[model samples]
Target: MHIEVAKKSLQKNNQEVYNFLIDIKNFEILMPENIDKFEVLDANTFKFALSGMPEIILRLKEQHPYEKIVLGAASDKLPFTLTVNIIATSENESEVGLSFEGEFNAMMAMMIKSPITNFMETLSKNMDKIA
Candidate 1:
Protein backbone atom coordinates (compact mmCIF):
# COMPACT_ATOMS: atom_id res chain seq x y z
CA MET A 1 0.00 0.00 0.00
CA HIS A 2 1.07 3.56 -0.63
CA ILE A 3 -0.03 6.79 1.01
CA GLU A 4 0.91 10.33 0.12
CA VAL A 5 0.38 13.02 2.71
CA ALA A 6 -0.24 16.68 2.04
CA LYS A 7 2.73 18.60 0.76
CA LYS A 8 3.82 21.79 2.49
CA SER A 9 5.64 24.81 1.21
CA LEU A 10 8.43 25.97 3.45
CA GLN A 11 10.31 29.22 3.65
CA LYS A 12 13.57 27.33 3.71
CA ASN A 13 15.21 26.15 0.53
CA ASN A 14 15.55 22.52 -0.48
CA GLN A 15 19.16 22.42 0.64
CA GLU A 16 18.22 23.72 4.06
CA VAL A 17 15.41 21.25 4.44
CA TYR A 18 17.58 18.44 3.15
CA ASN A 19 20.31 19.31 5.57
CA PHE A 20 17.90 19.19 8.49
CA LEU A 21 16.51 15.82 7.47
CA ILE A 22 19.89 14.23 6.82
CA ASP A 23 20.60 14.56 10.49
CA ILE A 24 18.79 11.83 12.36
CA LYS A 25 18.51 13.96 15.46
CA ASN A 26 16.00 16.28 13.80
CA PHE A 27 13.48 13.53 13.25
CA GLU A 28 12.10 13.84 16.74
CA ILE A 29 10.75 17.27 15.93
CA LEU A 30 8.69 15.78 13.12
CA MET A 31 6.99 13.16 15.26
CA PRO A 32 3.60 13.70 16.84
CA GLU A 33 3.36 15.28 20.27
CA ASN A 34 2.08 12.03 21.67
CA ILE A 35 5.24 10.15 20.77
CA ASP A 36 6.10 7.71 23.54
CA LYS A 37 9.81 7.57 22.96
CA PHE A 38 12.39 8.75 20.43
CA GLU A 39 16.02 7.80 20.16
CA VAL A 40 18.70 8.56 17.63
CA LEU A 41 20.89 5.50 17.59
CA ASP A 42 23.52 6.71 15.17
CA ALA A 43 24.10 9.03 12.28
CA ASN A 44 21.77 7.05 10.05
CA THR A 45 19.27 5.33 12.31
CA PHE A 46 16.56 6.19 14.79
CA LYS A 47 13.87 4.44 16.71
CA PHE A 48 10.55 5.85 17.83
CA ALA A 49 7.46 4.57 19.48
CA LEU A 50 4.00 6.00 19.41
CA SER A 51 1.52 5.61 22.28
CA GLY A 52 0.58 1.98 21.81
CA MET A 53 2.49 0.93 18.75
CA PRO A 54 5.57 -1.24 18.70
CA GLU A 55 8.84 0.59 18.65
CA ILE A 56 9.90 1.23 15.05
CA ILE A 57 13.50 1.32 13.97
CA LEU A 58 14.18 3.23 10.78
CA ARG A 59 17.50 3.32 8.99
CA LEU A 60 18.54 5.64 6.23
CA LYS A 61 18.01 3.69 3.07
CA GLU A 62 18.93 6.22 0.44
CA GLN A 63 19.54 9.92 -0.15
CA HIS A 64 19.46 12.02 -3.28
CA PRO A 65 21.36 15.04 -2.12
CA TYR A 66 18.86 17.91 -1.78
CA GLU A 67 16.10 16.13 -3.59
CA LYS A 68 14.96 13.25 -1.37
CA ILE A 69 15.59 10.95 1.57
CA VAL A 70 14.24 7.50 2.12
CA LEU A 71 14.15 5.50 5.35
CA GLY A 72 13.23 1.88 5.66
CA ALA A 73 12.01 -0.06 8.64
CA ALA A 74 14.63 -2.36 10.14
CA SER A 75 12.16 -5.08 10.91
CA ASP A 76 10.37 -7.08 8.29
CA LYS A 77 7.52 -7.71 10.67
CA LEU A 78 6.05 -4.40 9.63
CA PRO A 79 7.91 -3.61 6.46
CA PHE A 80 7.53 -0.05 5.25
CA THR A 81 9.42 2.77 3.60
CA LEU A 82 9.09 6.45 4.43
CA THR A 83 10.20 8.99 1.87
CA VAL A 84 10.64 12.72 2.15
CA ASN A 85 10.74 14.57 -1.16
CA ILE A 86 12.05 18.10 -1.45
CA ILE A 87 11.34 20.31 -4.42
CA ALA A 88 13.03 23.65 -4.75
CA THR A 89 10.60 26.40 -5.72
CA SER A 90 13.08 29.24 -5.54
CA GLU A 91 16.50 30.06 -4.19
CA ASN A 92 15.20 30.25 -0.65
CA GLU A 93 11.93 28.33 -0.73
CA SER A 94 10.80 24.78 -1.30
CA GLU A 95 8.00 22.23 -0.89
CA VAL A 96 8.24 19.10 1.20
CA GLY A 97 6.13 15.99 1.11
CA LEU A 98 6.04 12.61 2.80
CA SER A 99 5.06 9.31 1.27
CA PHE A 100 4.63 5.95 2.98
CA GLU A 101 4.71 2.57 1.30
CA GLY A 102 4.11 -0.62 3.23
CA GLU A 103 3.78 -4.29 2.53
CA PHE A 104 1.17 -5.93 4.69
CA ASN A 105 -1.48 -8.58 4.54
CA ALA A 106 -5.04 -7.49 3.93
CA MET A 107 -6.15 -7.85 7.53
CA MET A 108 -3.14 -6.03 8.92
CA ALA A 109 -3.39 -3.26 6.35
CA MET A 110 -7.02 -2.70 7.20
CA MET A 111 -6.20 -2.45 10.87
CA ILE A 112 -3.32 0.00 10.54
CA LYS A 113 -4.28 2.11 7.53
CA SER A 114 -5.94 4.95 9.39
CA PRO A 115 -3.27 5.35 12.02
CA ILE A 116 -0.47 5.11 9.46
CA THR A 117 -2.08 7.72 7.23
CA ASN A 118 -2.59 10.02 10.18
CA PHE A 119 1.01 9.57 11.20
CA MET A 120 2.31 10.48 7.74
CA GLU A 121 0.08 13.55 7.54
CA THR A 122 1.24 14.71 10.94
CA LEU A 123 4.83 14.27 9.87
CA SER A 124 4.24 16.26 6.70
CA LYS A 125 2.57 19.06 8.64
CA ASN A 126 5.52 19.21 10.95
CA MET A 127 7.92 19.94 8.06
CA ASP A 128 7.53 23.65 8.79
CA LYS A 129 9.56 23.11 11.91
CA ILE A 130 12.62 23.09 9.66
CA ALA A 131 11.81 26.55 8.39
Candidate 2:
Protein backbone atom coordinates (compact mmCIF):
# COMPACT_ATOMS: atom_id res chain seq x y z
CA MET A 1 0.00 0.00 0.00
CA HIS A 2 1.02 3.59 -0.56
CA ILE A 3 -0.08 6.78 1.14
CA GLU A 4 0.87 10.42 0.79
CA VAL A 5 -0.10 13.44 2.81
CA ALA A 6 0.84 17.10 2.74
CA LYS A 7 0.09 19.80 5.26
CA LYS A 8 1.13 23.34 6.05
CA SER A 9 2.35 24.42 9.46
CA LEU A 10 3.20 27.65 11.22
CA GLN A 11 6.61 26.47 12.28
CA LYS A 12 9.44 28.73 11.29
CA ASN A 13 11.84 26.44 9.46
CA ASN A 14 13.61 23.12 9.31
CA GLN A 15 15.31 23.62 12.66
CA GLU A 16 12.02 23.84 14.45
CA VAL A 17 10.71 20.85 12.59
CA TYR A 18 13.76 18.84 13.51
CA ASN A 19 13.31 19.69 17.16
CA PHE A 20 9.69 18.61 16.98
CA LEU A 21 10.75 15.31 15.49
CA ILE A 22 13.08 14.75 18.39
CA ASP A 23 10.32 15.52 20.83
CA ILE A 24 8.11 13.01 19.06
CA LYS A 25 10.69 10.32 19.66
CA ASN A 26 10.74 10.96 23.39
CA PHE A 27 7.10 11.58 24.07
CA GLU A 28 5.26 8.60 25.48
CA ILE A 29 2.04 9.87 24.00
CA LEU A 30 0.24 7.80 21.40
CA MET A 31 -2.38 8.34 18.79
CA PRO A 32 -5.46 6.15 18.80
CA GLU A 33 -5.33 2.98 20.86
CA ASN A 34 -2.17 4.43 22.39
CA ILE A 35 1.13 2.89 21.40
CA ASP A 36 2.51 0.52 23.97
CA LYS A 37 6.02 1.99 23.95
CA PHE A 38 8.37 4.24 22.01
CA GLU A 39 12.12 3.99 22.41
CA VAL A 40 14.69 6.37 21.05
CA LEU A 41 17.80 4.65 19.75
CA ASP A 42 19.77 7.78 18.92
CA ALA A 43 19.48 10.90 16.90
CA ASN A 44 17.14 10.13 14.01
CA THR A 45 16.34 6.55 14.99
CA PHE A 46 13.78 4.87 17.17
CA LYS A 47 11.79 1.69 17.85
CA PHE A 48 8.06 1.59 18.35
CA ALA A 49 5.69 -0.93 19.81
CA LEU A 50 2.07 -0.53 18.85
CA SER A 51 -0.71 -1.44 21.17
CA GLY A 52 -1.41 -5.15 21.05
CA MET A 53 1.37 -5.79 18.58
CA PRO A 54 5.03 -6.67 18.48
CA GLU A 55 7.68 -4.02 18.20
CA ILE A 56 8.33 -2.39 14.83
CA ILE A 57 11.86 -1.36 14.13
CA LEU A 58 12.37 2.04 12.49
CA ARG A 59 15.58 3.39 11.09
CA LEU A 60 16.37 6.80 9.78
CA LYS A 61 17.43 6.68 6.17
CA GLU A 62 18.11 10.36 5.60
CA GLN A 63 17.68 13.61 7.46
CA HIS A 64 18.39 17.29 6.98
CA PRO A 65 17.75 18.76 10.40
CA TYR A 66 14.06 19.48 9.76
CA GLU A 67 14.27 20.07 6.03
CA LYS A 68 13.55 16.40 5.44
CA ILE A 69 13.61 13.09 7.25
CA VAL A 70 13.20 9.66 5.76
CA LEU A 71 12.40 6.56 7.78
CA GLY A 72 12.17 2.87 7.04
CA ALA A 73 10.25 0.31 9.06
CA ALA A 74 10.67 -3.45 9.13
CA SER A 75 8.35 -5.79 10.92
CA ASP A 76 6.93 -9.27 10.80
CA LYS A 77 3.65 -8.44 9.08
CA LEU A 78 4.13 -5.28 7.07
CA PRO A 79 7.41 -3.73 6.19
CA PHE A 80 7.27 -0.16 4.90
CA THR A 81 9.55 2.69 3.92
CA LEU A 82 8.44 6.28 4.38
CA THR A 83 9.95 9.66 3.71
CA VAL A 84 8.81 12.90 5.31
CA ASN A 85 10.07 16.14 3.90
CA ILE A 86 9.56 19.49 5.56
CA ILE A 87 10.05 22.58 3.47
CA ALA A 88 10.27 26.09 4.73
CA THR A 89 8.12 28.51 2.79
CA SER A 90 9.05 31.54 4.83
CA GLU A 91 10.49 32.55 8.16
CA ASN A 92 7.31 31.50 9.94
CA GLU A 93 5.74 29.05 7.55
CA SER A 94 6.54 25.50 6.53
CA GLU A 95 4.98 22.51 4.86
CA VAL A 96 5.26 18.82 5.58
CA GLY A 97 4.94 16.15 2.96
CA LEU A 98 4.93 12.43 3.54
CA SER A 99 5.32 9.58 1.08
CA PHE A 100 4.94 5.94 2.07
CA GLU A 101 5.19 2.83 -0.03
CA GLY A 102 5.35 -0.81 0.92
CA GLU A 103 4.53 -4.32 -0.15
CA PHE A 104 2.15 -6.31 1.97
CA ASN A 105 0.70 -9.74 1.58
CA ALA A 106 -3.04 -9.82 0.93
CA MET A 107 -4.07 -10.86 4.41
CA MET A 108 -1.82 -8.46 6.27
CA ALA A 109 -2.43 -5.64 3.83
CA MET A 110 -6.12 -5.49 4.58
CA MET A 111 -5.71 -5.45 8.31
CA ILE A 112 -2.79 -3.05 8.44
CA LYS A 113 -3.89 -0.36 6.02
CA SER A 114 -6.65 1.14 8.10
CA PRO A 115 -4.61 1.39 11.26
CA ILE A 116 -1.64 2.79 9.45
CA THR A 117 -3.86 5.36 7.80
CA ASN A 118 -5.24 6.31 11.15
CA PHE A 119 -1.76 6.56 12.56
CA MET A 120 -0.70 8.90 9.79
CA GLU A 121 -3.70 11.07 10.30
CA THR A 122 -2.95 11.31 13.97
CA LEU A 123 0.66 12.08 13.21
CA SER A 124 -0.33 14.93 10.95
CA LYS A 125 -2.55 16.33 13.64
CA ASN A 126 0.22 16.09 16.15
CA MET A 127 2.63 17.88 13.89
CA ASP A 128 0.08 20.57 13.29
CA LYS A 129 -0.22 21.10 16.99
CA ILE A 130 3.50 21.63 17.34
CA ALA A 131 3.63 23.88 14.34
Candidate 3:
Protein backbone atom coordinates (compact mmCIF):
# COMPACT_ATOMS: atom_id res chain seq x y z
CA MET A 1 0.00 0.00 0.00
CA HIS A 2 0.97 3.62 -0.44
CA ILE A 3 0.02 6.74 1.53
CA GLU A 4 0.12 10.48 0.97
CA VAL A 5 -0.64 13.53 3.13
CA ALA A 6 -0.91 17.22 2.32
CA LYS A 7 -1.22 19.99 4.90
CA LYS A 8 -1.30 23.77 4.71
CA SER A 9 0.22 25.66 7.61
CA LEU A 10 -0.45 29.27 8.55
CA GLN A 11 2.08 31.66 7.09
CA LYS A 12 4.92 33.13 9.10
CA ASN A 13 8.25 34.88 8.49
CA ASN A 14 10.03 33.25 5.58
CA GLN A 15 13.57 33.65 6.90
CA GLU A 16 12.56 32.35 10.27
CA VAL A 17 11.03 29.25 8.74
CA TYR A 18 14.05 28.79 6.49
CA ASN A 19 16.38 29.04 9.42
CA PHE A 20 14.21 26.56 11.25
CA LEU A 21 14.71 24.07 8.44
CA ILE A 22 18.45 24.59 8.39
CA ASP A 23 18.77 24.03 12.09
CA ILE A 24 17.90 20.37 11.67
CA LYS A 25 19.01 19.55 15.20
CA ASN A 26 16.17 21.53 16.69
CA PHE A 27 13.60 18.99 15.48
CA GLU A 28 14.01 17.06 18.70
CA ILE A 29 13.05 20.09 20.72
CA LEU A 30 10.03 20.85 18.55
CA MET A 31 8.72 17.32 18.36
CA PRO A 32 10.50 15.50 21.10
CA GLU A 33 8.36 12.40 21.24
CA ASN A 34 8.22 11.78 17.50
CA ILE A 35 11.73 12.69 16.52
CA ASP A 36 14.43 10.87 18.40
CA LYS A 37 17.50 12.22 16.63
CA PHE A 38 18.15 14.45 13.66
CA GLU A 39 21.74 14.68 12.41
CA VAL A 40 23.00 16.74 9.54
CA LEU A 41 25.47 14.44 7.89
CA ASP A 42 26.33 17.05 5.31
CA ALA A 43 24.81 20.03 3.56
CA ASN A 44 22.13 17.92 1.85
CA THR A 45 22.20 14.70 3.75
CA PHE A 46 21.12 13.57 7.20
CA LYS A 47 20.13 10.65 9.38
CA PHE A 48 17.10 10.59 11.65
CA ALA A 49 15.39 8.40 14.16
CA LEU A 50 11.60 8.18 14.16
CA SER A 51 9.29 7.13 16.90
CA GLY A 52 9.55 3.45 17.85
CA MET A 53 12.03 2.76 15.13
CA PRO A 54 15.72 2.65 14.36
CA GLU A 55 17.55 5.48 12.73
CA ILE A 56 16.68 5.88 9.04
CA ILE A 57 18.88 7.48 6.45
CA LEU A 58 17.50 10.46 4.53
CA ARG A 59 19.00 12.58 1.80
CA LEU A 60 17.67 15.99 0.94
CA LYS A 61 16.79 15.31 -2.65
CA GLU A 62 15.88 18.93 -3.18
CA GLN A 63 15.82 22.07 -1.08
CA HIS A 64 15.08 25.75 -1.64
CA PRO A 65 15.28 27.79 1.51
CA TYR A 66 11.82 29.09 2.51
CA GLU A 67 10.43 27.51 -0.63
CA LYS A 68 10.61 23.74 -0.62
CA ILE A 69 12.38 20.66 0.72
CA VAL A 70 12.09 17.06 -0.45
CA LEU A 71 13.43 14.03 1.43
CA GLY A 72 13.54 10.36 0.50
CA ALA A 73 13.73 7.41 2.87
CA ALA A 74 14.21 3.71 2.25
CA SER A 75 13.35 1.11 4.85
CA ASP A 76 12.24 -2.46 4.94
CA LYS A 77 9.11 -1.61 6.88
CA LEU A 78 8.10 1.36 4.74
CA PRO A 79 9.96 2.74 1.81
CA PHE A 80 8.58 6.21 1.20
CA THR A 81 9.33 9.62 -0.19
CA LEU A 82 8.22 12.77 1.62
CA THR A 83 8.17 16.13 -0.09
CA VAL A 84 7.62 19.32 1.84
CA ASN A 85 7.12 22.56 -0.02
CA ILE A 86 7.17 25.87 1.84
CA ILE A 87 5.98 28.97 0.10
CA ALA A 88 6.13 32.48 1.48
CA THR A 89 2.87 34.29 0.93
CA SER A 90 4.12 37.48 2.57
CA GLU A 91 6.94 38.77 4.72
CA ASN A 92 5.34 37.30 7.83
CA GLU A 93 3.38 34.55 6.11
CA SER A 94 4.16 31.20 4.51
CA GLU A 95 2.56 27.83 3.92
CA VAL A 96 3.92 24.32 4.06
CA GLY A 97 2.35 21.63 1.86
CA LEU A 98 3.61 18.12 2.49
CA SER A 99 3.25 15.25 0.04
CA PHE A 100 4.10 11.67 0.98
CA GLU A 101 4.16 8.71 -1.37
CA GLY A 102 5.40 5.17 -0.89
CA GLU A 103 4.68 1.47 -0.68
CA PHE A 104 3.93 -0.83 2.24
CA ASN A 105 1.99 -3.98 2.90
CA ALA A 106 -1.71 -3.42 3.60
CA MET A 107 -1.67 -4.11 7.31
CA MET A 108 1.31 -1.93 7.99
CA ALA A 109 -0.05 0.81 5.77
CA MET A 110 -3.32 1.02 7.66
CA MET A 111 -1.54 1.05 11.00
CA ILE A 112 0.86 3.78 9.99
CA LYS A 113 -1.46 6.20 8.24
CA SER A 114 -3.36 7.38 11.30
CA PRO A 115 -0.27 8.22 13.30
CA ILE A 116 1.34 9.87 10.35
CA THR A 117 -1.72 12.03 9.80
CA ASN A 118 -1.81 12.95 13.44
CA PHE A 119 1.85 13.78 13.37
CA MET A 120 1.42 16.09 10.42
CA GLU A 121 -1.47 17.88 12.09
CA THR A 122 0.51 18.33 15.27
CA LEU A 123 3.55 19.54 13.40
CA SER A 124 1.56 22.10 11.45
CA LYS A 125 -0.12 23.37 14.58
CA ASN A 126 3.23 23.95 16.27
CA MET A 127 4.95 25.73 13.39
CA ASP A 128 4.01 29.17 14.68
CA LYS A 129 5.44 28.44 18.09
CA ILE A 130 8.64 27.11 16.61
CA ALA A 131 8.96 29.92 14.12
Give all candidates' CA lDDT scores: 0.92, 0.70, 0.66
Top TM-score prediction, candidate number:
1
In the range 47-81, model 2's lDDT, one tens digit per residue, is 88778767777777766786777778745356688
Ranking by lDDT: 1, 2, 3
Candidate 1 per-residue C-alpha lDDT over 1-131 given as tens digits, one digit per residue, 9 for 90 to 100: 99898899999999999999999889999999989999999899999999989889999999999999999998887889999999999999999989999999999999988999999988888888984
- Cα deviation in Å at residue 121, candidate 1? 1.0
lDDT of 3 by residue, 10-126 (tens): 656666776776665545454546677778777656777777867777666666877776777744455777676777787777787666677877787787787767655665666
Which ten-residue region of model 2 has the weakest summed lDDT? 24-33
Q: Which one wins by TM-score: 2 or 3? A: 2
What TM-score, to 2 decimals, does candidate 1 have?
0.96
Name the better of 1 and 3 by TM-score.
Answer: 1
Clashes of each: 0, 0, 3
Q: Which ten residues in a row have the lowest lDDT in candidate 1?
A: 122-131
At residue 72, give the lDDT of candidate 2: 83
Error of 1 at 96 (Å): 0.8
